[model samples]
Target: MRPDSAVSVPDMPAIDLQDVSKTYGSVVALDQVSLRVEAGEWLAVMGPSGSGKTTLVNLAGCLDTPSSGSVWVDGVDVSSFSRRELARFRAEKIGFIFQQFHLVPYLTALENILLAQYFHSLADAAEAMAALERVGMAHRARHLPGQLSGGEQQRVSIARALINDPAIILADEPTGNLDERNEEAVMELLRAAHQAGKTLVMVTHDPTIARYADRRIQLHHGRITDISIFSEDDEREFDQILSKLWTLRENHEPLHDDSLRIAGPLSVGRAIAAMTARGWLCRENGRITLLPPGEKRASDLIRRHRLTELLFSHTFELRNEAELEDQAFKFEHSLSPEATARICAFLGHPRACPHGSPIPQGDCCPAAS
Candidate 1:
């Protein structure tokens, strides 16, 4: 929805910061920051705590103005807007999703969404309910924020953010308070919004979460230190190598330098050395073993692989062992933890795959007996 409050200037970026700096007395939050968020682009801002990630999002959302230079949103110079104008402009053009799930304590789920609609334009009950339904939260429309689970509350917050049909969605650590399943649910909604042409500027501390964006920027002491664009081939190679190591460990087989099984099309020796350098695994006394962090990552990947096997077996009724293994290998890396959980739940949380191998328990699985 185009906001009437701000006139669109031709050839201007969707969200732009020109040499912006923000300070609080003796402390500097952002220094000489210049950023441009293109229309329909997803940009991730990543940094450690006290690294000015939040400050950058706040400026883009128009929640706070820059101490120097200018901040512009939707081609308008928001830095020059009056307080009332800024509020109106933000309401119409920007939607915010906070990590804290900032729903009003006293308001019910539906009511909270209506509040956002009230701010943006006329509050229509039908539209608000539709928004909740989109996020699969319509059944709990009457529940208050206090009565909902963390995931439920976040879903309600998402509904509220989209109620206005804003062009830009600013999210700050949106999945910070969620578990694996809930985080997947929240990301699915955000991905849908991005697909619908909403520009997303999200601040995150998790590398996995940051990978969802088109580009990622790292902040250090209020300065943009690095920018990264992802390559799919790099990720695929890493997953393939890790999976081979995981299989060896799970089968109680030693990963000796002469283990030809692990040496596939890729240079297995170099891959193992790289993983060891990254602290994902260790090579000692001519044997290789996974470190704690690497074990967990490999476990998740294996879980996804077995779950995919189960899904394919049931859906396609395929009984060929080679076919199932081939399909599972190709599809496993594409499944998110959340999607794997759903597949597991759909299959009644089976403990074993079609080949009778025990499936690894995911976070969404019930406790083992």
Candidate 2:
């Protein structure tokens, strides 16, 4: 479907924002912004306080409407949804996670997750148990939120978000309440969920945590400042290309101009031309196919892209999706292959770009090592 037509219908963007704006009297919480997040994408929203990160998420999750512009979840525009429509939309399409666990004080982990299902139907204990199991928290399912550690409570919260099989999960600092170790643990769970094809968008101040996203978006003073899928550096050029390819594998869409920023101006035509000149590309069914060195080269590029995205997302505390991608693109092509590989190892072989694409495999990925 055309991008424009999809805006009004029940579309499937884990989250979609189109020239969306929100204002409170004289204060603008969000300026005009347009973004689209596909299914299974994990997008991190970053910014300093009052940058409109929360406002954007609220708009996407149906908690708030844009003062002007449009908000769509899974293709359905909810800008003017009625109270019942809003409630139903939230119940069927969105799952929310906050810094605070928000578990009912009197409820066990199992009960907490089950309570979420009650909105749609009667609470189902068995379903709740399965949800807990998915988060690796089944053993603690009977434990009350207060009895669990911050990380554990967060896990229960995540399970609750999943109880209804939501199309998108909106996480606002899911790791904020935990220490370093617990934060890592919670991030691991989130990573697993992303790998399993859940669409996730998170708002976070912690750059390190944000690196776990498929894409990082930075918001500045109520406007999108930048977006990134990788980091910058000479050695990372190939990795950026590979990363883009992995992300676009299923769609075959041409890389966007913004994406080109990651690895310099080397266009797909240029990359293919260069590779073909070197006997690395073979045409197959009007599409380019990699052979031998082609795959290796692609893998190297992906490694660099992933590493760059990781580093910049951490360094700048970027949450705005566009800014993060721009930063990664600027420096990703300069990293040495060895350095890029090391960074990838440090980051635990991320499977997709911040926008949720599989990371191409070659000498730079974990298995390659």
Model 1 regions lying over 4 Å from their true place: 1-11, 241-295, 302-328, 334-361, 364-369
TM-score of 2: 0.61
Residue 113 lDDT, candidate 1, scale 0-100: 95
How many residue pairs clash in all the candidates, one count each? Answer: 0, 58
Error of 1 at 107 (Å): 1.5
- Tens-digit lDDT string for candidate 1 (1-369): 435523445566789999999999989999999998888889999877898999999889988889998998987899877778888889988989999999999999999999998887788898889999999999999999999999999999999988888889999999999987799899989999999888899998765677789888888899998776646754566566667777776688877656634434346676566455444678889787777757777777877888889899999887899999898888876776667889989988888888777788877789999
Q: Looking at candidate 2, what is the lDDT of residue 41?
A: 89
Clash pairs (backbone) in predicted model 1: none
Worst 10 residues of 2 by lDDT: 1-10
